[model samples]
Target: MFMGDGMSLPTLAAARTLLGQRAGRPGEETQLSFEAFPTVGLAKTYCVNSQTADSSCSATALLCGVKSNAFTLGLTAAVPRRDCAASQVPAARLDSVAAWALAAGRDAGVVTTTRVTHASPAGIYARAAERNWETDADVLADGVDVDACPDIAHQLVHLAPGNQFKVILGGGRREFLNITSVDDEGTPGKRTDGRNLIEEWQADKARRNVTYQYAWNHEQLLQANATLPEYLLGLFESDHLRYNLETDHTTEPTLAELTEVAIRMLSRNEKGFFLFVEGGRIDHAHHDNQVHLALDETIELSAAVARALQLLDEKDSLIVVTADHTHVMAFNGYSTRGADVLGPSNMRDSAGVPFMTLSYTNGPGRRPDVDGRRPDVTLEEGFRSPRWRTHVDVPLASETHGSDDVPVFAWGVHHEMFSGLYEQSHVPHRMAYAGCFGGGPQACDAAAAPSALVMPLVMALLALLRALA
Candidate 1:
């Protein structure tokens, strides 16, 4: 499933029009790819500690079948946010659906536009007290807990049983490499412990007698063979991958391309695969109040979903597309039928001052000019230009996440069960039930298995007939 982060219904409403304008079409007639999914459900995204959800809490709820506090991942709500001590409690640690999939004899993978260890994607295998503990530097920055938790990147390479990932792709090479090593762009490393985790990862795989490959750019990843049983990793940027709007196609593959490669690598397993693909930058764009950039990110995410659908068989595969939460960006002002979503509204207030068709409820670039003065920007330049920043009601440095229910779009096997409103924690249950993995309702029944008696007899008869011939 595709996640358009901070994508409320209104954000999507504006984005649909904005996307068509970018394609040289009338704004009203366009449809974002996932709009066509047959079943749509609303998910309540509140966390136990806060009304509005953060990515860590939402990630735990959706991936681990439990709701957690704001900054924790794979832990129950009982663990206080950032309480490094409580993070080690056995009752607080929850296993992910990915772990369950592995136990069910399925391979698993994770892909994202953000760092592989970022909050939402780390839910695939990590169980930590804080999402910010992405590197050794972070652990050193704060008071020590009774038990020292390894950073997120460390967990990916050296996690416990049932956490073996077949593929892990996205950014954050700086976290893995040594502080002395320069990045692809010749930037200094972010690591403090001076460990080259990439080498460590390869060495660990070799010890297990496993075929493995690591790629740092688009071409390298494309050239790697997926037909062979191998663990593959692609880290294209020191930090997060560049946004789709400004990235070079040659050096950076789109999210769709990444999804295709990941699926192919994981699909070699006869037991099947579980892949988590995140359009992670959409949330960043919204936080920066970059309307067009956010929508573009969403467009790329939708394409990734479409590509996955083509690669998967609907009969056995279950695809879920939903957002972790939303933004407070307002899409009002009665602009005409064909008005640009990224352009200004023709209507003005009593003082006769023009405003944007889209504005956030709270964010940066929001100014209160009592003298009625405005910036020198025109519709031709649009909000995308470096000079223009969208105005908001509140003048905060970054936009706040909204508590509104996000939409869940599902297709493929057991798609019928995704209807009706539900709690976010209920998601992993539905997924487990659908895939026949974990302790789900359908996992225990003998009927869940393929006809045991009939299948063996059929195989024996076929073998006898072949011998006779």
Candidate 2:
């Protein structure tokens, strides 16, 4: 399963329809399919009604098989009202698939294009108060309620009695470093709590027979061999990793690179593994209404999925790919194959046709200038106006997530379990069921017992092959 970020079922369906029609010949029609997890119906049935399927609840549902209130991780809706299990004293919470894998002695890892503490990946490991609340010196020194779930950084270090995860990679150095600790660039800072989380992690790893390596850049990551560390930490920045579209000072690794490294490290475990990879920035792009940025991130996510397919053996390993939620995107007109993905706004008139094309719907106080012309300066500089001028008119509304059901695609042992639409919370349970983590017949049971007992396609092919040979 390859999950794309902010993928709207309706928008994707429209795009596929256009692509098929454009690709089809007079007599032939092309069929297009959506492979991300579908959205749940009945309002709070699939998701807790919130402003959006923000990563916190979405990821919680994906990983823990529970729908949480928005912004809370690893807690049930009754957490606020009833003080659920996660809100209690931390012994060892095993709600996450990652935790289940760790408990089963299988290696587990999480890789993301955002801060490891961010909602999507953190949903797998850390059960915290709010996704946005990272541990600051002031917050911690105030004798923060230990019973209140800690941030991802604290959870990564102290989730299990022992360091549980074998591999942990992605940004969020600020969360690990003391509030006062300056970054390697000699930047001045202070550890607010006067305790260095990185040192604590290293010391803990050394004492617990765990090898630990923390890498801040691509060079450091490449230098550290798979043999060195059973537990790895790669936080390339203080916050979210740099987006692939933006060139920045930070040495961020692409999602594909991070996935490859994690697979190599985690596969060494004999018990097999479960890893969660997130293309988190895609959702961010959608929130900002940057379609081009969103599509680019989606393509990168596809590349990572392709990498997973290349690395994993389908016979033993189950790779479940899915997104937490959907964004509201649409395709109003017929768009040709490989049409300027950035579209006409970036083009200029070649002849009688107006060539340069770019577009956007209404966003943040955007209005036409006096003459209905493009603003002189950049969109960022143009206040009280919409950016990304467009000839196409969309419904006047802020961008949002659609209520429509999304799609999920699966391949490998239990891939068939993902065939039909299901509730978002059912995903983790399905994967766990397939992976043999949950108590049930493995996904292969479904695969082995086919419906209606049709003739063996393999046998038919073999007979044809023998005849041809």
Candidate 3:
């Protein structure tokens, strides 16, 4: 659970001046990490209790700590409303800490840069209603019943209930076939849903003995074969997989090469796995305000969290990093740490004088010109453009979602319960009580009681000034 891709809090305080560091204002602990909340009063209880921290209520509060509504997933928060009446909704189905680590037998995987049926990796494997309608226009505009909304290509050929996912990589190969199907690299326009979901996940891994591989590129995901079929499925593209500044020349791979081939196919399942990697275009470069493509998708989501801290082991793995809301893009003035985080000498101007790099505090057809050049356009283009800087400024706003407050980082094991201020659906029950699966530390004592005494002495004095800077 170390997902970083559209983390806001002033773009992590302008990406802490490109690593010279700032945020908590101490020192060191850099290598980028953060945890701050308040996403506009948790998005007004996620759009009036239809719970929506967006990214599908932060992927159902980080894969089922429960907090639906915002086009739900997994289900809880009283299910219902898919325009009701599918026998009146309500069966709900909670579980999911990757199905409780595949029901304690461990080994579970989901890597993504987007399109493992989108919406934050299909809210960790299916539960629909427009997280971009995973196709079939997301079950005919969320009225359900496109054979009842399973979708992420029918949950990667059936996931949950004791099928222990070995490793299912990203991208959505056109929601698993039917646009005129044809894989084997001919690349036809598939997705009519003729159920070729990769041949029904290779015929359900040859009658459930499990051991599969279905890649799409990067030399068949680096010539797969980690002893065949640890249940891997790559899906290079069909929608939403392309920004590493537009896939570095395609043939697709990088999200740190699909999280290092999903940590070598879920670390060869020695029963110690629950992986979910998503850098999801940092929320499409903050829904297109494109701050240099959202700081190069937050530096490739911190290079996939430095490739999961170079293959996990921070004391029996826990990792937790976070983000599900925030995006206003800030950096009030001042520069010179590492600078050049893509232009305008990092930024200044307004007599503090720096001079243009990029800007936007408000959007959608701006105006104002008493003969100052660049105006005369308005082809029925209504107006509004508060000369962009940062923070809210509406009128016809599109580049949205900024209820400010996002930043959550942790190292490992019980990560001191993600230090400080919570409630974006109590971050998946504080990461399912740091992976022992809930009910631990008295079930996150009121959400880890205000960052338990100032986030470990301020992240141990900023990790000793980022290890002696």
Candidate 4:
């Protein structure tokens, strides 16, 4: 499964055009990698408690096969955010697709451009009352007992599915190291418990008599013995990996490179493997209203998906591409053929000012009126820079998520199962059904055969009913 966090339809459309223009072709003639999928569907992204979903709950829904409250991960709505006691209830904790895959004797791994403990990737293993609790220090500062509610990073190293993962690659190394220790990048660790989880992880793997390798930079990752390690862990940065535009090729790996390595490691298991790849920094870029960065991240995600396709066998494997949520970024204006997506539009507004081709509903990019005239986006000093923020209607410290329904694209085996509009929670269920794992109805089960036949019709009816409701 591949998820591009906060990748809305608008973002994809704009990114496709931008990519084509860079290739010296008519913008509309291009397609993002996932756009070529054989089957496509839409998913409603609202959370149990909010009209607009947050990454935590949306990821839980996408991975756990159930909807959860906003700001919570791997829990049912019964466990509200910040309610540590309630989160301890066994019934409240949800098992994600990763757990299901592991239980079925399939190896699983995760790759992302964000912290491994961040909400989206953490949804695969960590169950937390609050998404911010990435380390012992964070939990302690929240007035929560670290022993009772282990931090997300601790869960990744010590918990069941996460510990069993064959390949774990991403950033957030500081969360795994002791506070007194410094990383190769000279960044201080944040754990207050003095536990160096990375070292502990190595010791655990050694105790199991299994071969493992850990890499802190791109050179080490590239030089890793391709067929030697049974498990691999790579952390290239203390926080999220640098955005692709600013990444150091020698020190940090691109999303496509991470995806390629993760596949090579996980595919060693004859029982097959389940891998989760996330373009998580796209969300961070969207929050900052940096449309250029967000679009570049989306393009990187497309490349990663393309890389995965090259290594996978469509006859047996199932590949899914979707987003956990959507951003408030809006792409509009009638620009001439092959115009720059990051530049101002050709048409002037009623006030005789050229607005950006891409803008936001609310963000730090909100411009104040000067003498009753909106600032012309074309005149901004850094308007062409990747760090430039597009214009927004409402002022906010950071842009917010949109309640828009996200698109789901599918290819490979049983792709037909994901062909109609459905709730976001239905995503993993469909995947589980197709993969014939998890407690849900499975494609391999005789009783589920009939229901699977009419699922598309039923889904279409439900969507119509929802619209009517």
Candidate 5:
């Protein structure tokens, strides 16, 4: 499955227009890979406690089959947010689809543009009272429950069994090393516990006699597929891989390449596999009000989905594409059919002022005048390019996520179950049923109706052959 972070319906529409316009057509007719999926459904991306949820809560609802409070991962609403003491409760914790699949003897892996222990990926395995507890430094941040609640990175290394997630690939190298040691970028480590988790993982691999390999950069990762190790861990950048627009493809690989490598490695499992790929930084770009960056991230995620489709069996393997939440960016103004989506609207306002075709409810784009009303927004002199910030209605340094329903697109096994609106928590259950995981071992049986159509003809042919004998 692929999760497009902060991908709203309007975002998809705007991006689609730009995509086709760049493809030498009137951009409105094109469809992104997710948009073209056969079965589409809407998911209500809200948590139990709030109308609009953060990644931590929404991801839990997406992966764990339960809605959790904001800033908490892998725990239900019974657990208080940011209270270190209540984090020790057993009922507070919840199991993930990853664990469910692992217990059923299938391999699982997670690939993300953000840190591996970040909110969405952490929902698959790690648990924390606060999502900010990504490192030991954060566990102690503002006197959090360092003892009762371990950091997310720590749980990834120590809490999981040896066979857990045969593959773990993403950024944040220094977060695993000791605080005393310098990171790949020469920054001090964030872990206060003296334990160098990376080295510990390596030692454990050796002691247990598992074929494991570690890659700190892209070059080493490139060599990984050739050798085909049993376990792979790649920690590429200190933070998120650069925004798609800002990425230097020479130094770091794109999200598509990472996903391709992960699929190649995990395909070795004979029992079957479950993979989670997160286009995590799309949300980050939206928060910063960078429209191009967000669109490029979505485009990259769609490419990754296409790559997986090429690698997996369409008849058996199910593919689900969805978003954890929505952003505040909105499409406005009445423009021509083929108008540049990123440029200003075709028509003018009452004051003979043209606003941007794309604007936010609240963001840095709102440059207000003396009376607090935004002035006439116009294209720069001599620049007809469609690249510029959209005007905004409210003033805020960073835009907040939108509280609304997001779309879910699916293909392969049991795609019909995704036809109607459902709570976000139903995602994992439906996927489990479609993929024949957990308690839904026979749920996918009815999906093979087409293959069953040939059975009666084959039976008749067999009886005729026996009569001839």
Candidate 6:
């Protein structure tokens, strides 16, 4: 499964247009990798306590198959954010699809541009009361018992499912190291407990006698043998990976490279594997109102999905692509065909000022009017820069998520089941059905006929079973 964080319909539309223009064609005629999927659906992205869901709540819904309260990860709504006592309750703690995959004797792995302990990736294995409690210092600062509520970084390295992962690749090396220690890049770690989780992860694998490799840079990742290692842990950056436009390809791996290596290692399992690949920086860019970077990250996500497809067989494998939530970024304006998406719109405002095609509803991008007039976008230096923030109506530190349904695109192996609208929580259940894992009805079960060709037989067996009972 793959998710583009904060990649809304408008975001995809804009990225596709930008892609087409880059391909030297009319911008509207292009399709991203997932757009060609046979089954397409929409998922409502509201949380249990909020109309507009944050990454943690949405990640819980998408990965755990349950809607959770805002700011919580891998726990049900019964556990409110920052409730350390409540989060410890096993009933309140939810198991994600990774647990389900492991229960069925399949391996699972996670790859993201964000820190492994960040909200989205943490949903796979972490059971936390708060998303921001990524380190011991963070939990203690929030007045929570550090030992009782272990930080997310500790949970991933020492806990179940996460330790069993065949592949764990992403940024955030600092989260796994101690404050006193520095990484190869001389970056200080974030842990205050004086424990280095990265070394612990390596030591654990060593004790198990498994072939594992730990990589901290692009060269290290490339040098690691994909087939020889039973496990792999790669942390490319101290924080989140750099924006695609700013990254040095020699030191930092692209999203596509990470996805490719993950697939190569995970596909070795005969029982199959469940991999979660996330373009997490897309959300970060949108939060900063950097439309160019957001679009580039979306394109990077498409490339990653394409790489996964190239390595898998459609006959047996399943690929589902969707977003956790939408953003407040708006792509508007009428311009001539093949016009630059990054350029100003053809239609001017009431003040005869041309605004960029992209803009945010609320962000630091909001510029104060001069003499009761909107500034001309074309006149500003760095206006077309990748880090440029477009126009905004409301002034805020960061843009918020939009309360809109996200699109779901599914391909391969009973993809038809993904058709039509559904709640965000049902996503993993549908995936479990297709993969024949978890407690729910599955394609492997005779009574659950996902395909039309077997509906009659399924009905006959259902009737016979009811009669027998």
TM of each candidate vs. truth: 0.91, 0.76, 0.31, 0.94, 0.90, 0.95
In terms of TM-score, the best-performing candidate is: 6
The residue-by-residue lDDT of candidate 1 on 1-469, one tens digit each, is 4566667787777777877887898776887777777888999999998899999899998889788899889999888867777888888889898888888888888898998889999877888788898887777676654137778888887785323888888988888876888877786666677788888888898899998888888888887743434888788899999999889989887899999988899888887877888999888888888877887788888789889889899888888988888888788889888798887787875666678887788888676666666542354354446335688778889889999999888888888788999998898888888888888676335564667777999999999999999
Writing each residue's lDDT as its tens digit, candidate 6 over 393-439 gives 99999988899999999999989988899999999999999999998
* Quality of model 2 by C-alpha lDDT: 0.62
Clashes found in each candidate (C-alpha, N, C closer than 3 A): 2, 19, 30, 0, 1, 0
Whole-model lDDT values for every prediction? 0.81, 0.62, 0.61, 0.92, 0.82, 0.92
Question: What is the Å distance of residue 327 in model 1 from its true position?
Answer: 0.7
lDDT (tens digit, per residue) of candidate 4 on 312-414:
9999899999999999998889988788878888888889988988999998998899889998877779877999889999999999999999999999989
lDDT of 5 at 416: 83
Q: Write the per-residue lDDT of candidate 5 for residues 378-428, one digit (tens) a residue.
A: 645433322345566787888899999989999987888898999999999
For candidate 6, report its TM-score.
0.95
- Give the alpha carbon lDDT tens digit for every residue of 213-244 in model 2: 98888877776644547778787776777778
lDDT, residue 445, candidate 6:
84
Q: Better model by lDDT, 1 or 2?
A: 1
Query: RMSD in angstroms, all models?
Result: 6.9, 9.7, 21.5, 7.2, 6.1, 3.3
**Which stretches of model 3 miss by more than 4 angstroms?**
6-9, 13-108, 111-113, 117-171, 175-178, 181-197, 207-238, 241-270, 290-316, 320-330, 333-370, 373-408, 414-469
CA shift of 37, model 6, Å: 1.1
Q: What is the lDDT of candidate 1?
A: 0.81
lDDT of 3 by residue, 272-369 (tens): 77787877777666565556556566766676677767777777776666777765555554545544543454444333433323334544423443
* Model 6 misplaced regions, further than 4 Å: 225-227, 447-469
TM for candidate 4 is 0.94
What value does the lDDT take at residue 272 in candidate 5? 80
| CA error at residue 454 for candidate 3, angstroms | 40
TM-score, cand. 5 vs. native: 0.90
